[model samples]
Target: MGTNTILDMRGYRRPEPGTQPAYLFPPYKSTLRRAPTKPLVLLPHTLSEVTGPVFGHDAISPGDDDLTHANGGEAIGPRIIVSGRVLEEDGRPVPNALVEVWQANAGGRYRHRNCQPHSPLDPNFNGYGRVMTNSEGRYRFQSIKPGPYPWGNHSNAWRPSHIHFSLFGPAFVSRLVTQMYFEGDPLLPFDPIYNSIPDENARKLLISSFDWETTVPDHANGYHFDIVLRGRNETPMENKR
Candidate 1:
């Protein structure tokens, strides 16, 4: 066998219909410019993609899970504790997975220069955190509730409060990116990105439920948002290029 020889492992399964958003959704204006015009060519998975190095505790710092006090001071906003598990399609726990999250500040402003100028930024909030799933595939983190901001996609178009989540299962090929919306967000109905998923039930999976059990006394509210890698009940990931 050669050093570049690919593994003959079982290939990944295809996602069910309507579970994922189409690459070209007109409502999401940005997709118009990025969506592929030609048919997508599926490529075979290589050994590097399936058996790549994974990030572990060594890559994570002590305070990486707590975004509230990541900086010198505490961030201003309603603090929230988000906890959940990463599961495989068969409902098996995916342990030691790298879960990263990033979001806008409480005022709907990001630290990036391209962020909306109207909303003020929170100096104490960098709005980024990461953690590895435990033996039970559970992970937890703290952050400020992000505020909605206008994106000018359509007339009076505003996005719902959402946090971006990225997870690496066991290898680079298992990486997935998705967004978690807060339950009962009125903006959900108007957000094209959230509505892009054809399956109503799958869309609901992206919304995190309020978890009173994880809430701290007078400190932070808790929310639970589990992720399903693949299956009929898989969570809707972002469209691939």
Candidate 2:
């Protein structure tokens, strides 16, 4: 049986009529109505431009520092550096793109509903952060290595280590909602979210490579994950459909 069918049979709530499936619809709609036909412009390669700083400021970079949110309590874990480029399908840089990342804290926990009850919540680990691509379409953040947590799937099942990524292209039509996975994560093969991508090439695109250079002192490890936003395609009059 299909995964959804099994879940539904197990009493998982189904959407009401006229409502979209929770996992099927995007959170927001694009305002753009027309697709551009010109050749896609790739973003620049050199990092430049000072977009505003991101959240988790105190926790950024590797360190033994504590993560205390506005609420209270300390977040524990190893520091990690997450960096990547925003590019177009043609491998061109896409500057000014907005990249947002949200993830669980070190103890394999999150501030969300499914998190463990005993895990001390870190007020600082709000799990939400945003950054803009520089002139070279680059972005970076320092965070703790998120631990895999269990769900209802099996006796010992666990979600993979992942970071949620939201990207807004220069044009409204270029928006994308995706997640980045760490290389060699054991849960990748079993995670329902990761298996949702039908295409292997597309699936691999979400897994980031480890980059030692980006690992700043106090950071646990470094990851460089790039994303390519689809851009307008150029076509001659005769080639227009």
lDDT of 1 by residue, 99-192 (tens): 8899999988888988869788888999899899999999999999999988989999999999999888875566789999999999999999
Give the TM-scores of the predictions, in the order they appear.
0.90, 0.66
Alpha-carbon runs more than 4 Å astray in model 1:
1-8, 46-49, 231-241
Backbone clashes in candidate 2 total 16
The residue-level lDDT of candidate 2 at 92 comes to 84
For residues 41-135, could you state the per-residue lDDT of candidate 2 as single tens digits? 64321112112223332333333222323346444677777888999766889886777678887666788886666456666677777777778
lDDT of 2 at 45: 19
Model 1 has an lDDT value of: 0.85
For every model shown, the clashing-pair count is 0, 16
Candidate 2 at residue 131, lDDT? 74
Write down the lDDT of every candidate, Cα atoms only: 0.85, 0.64
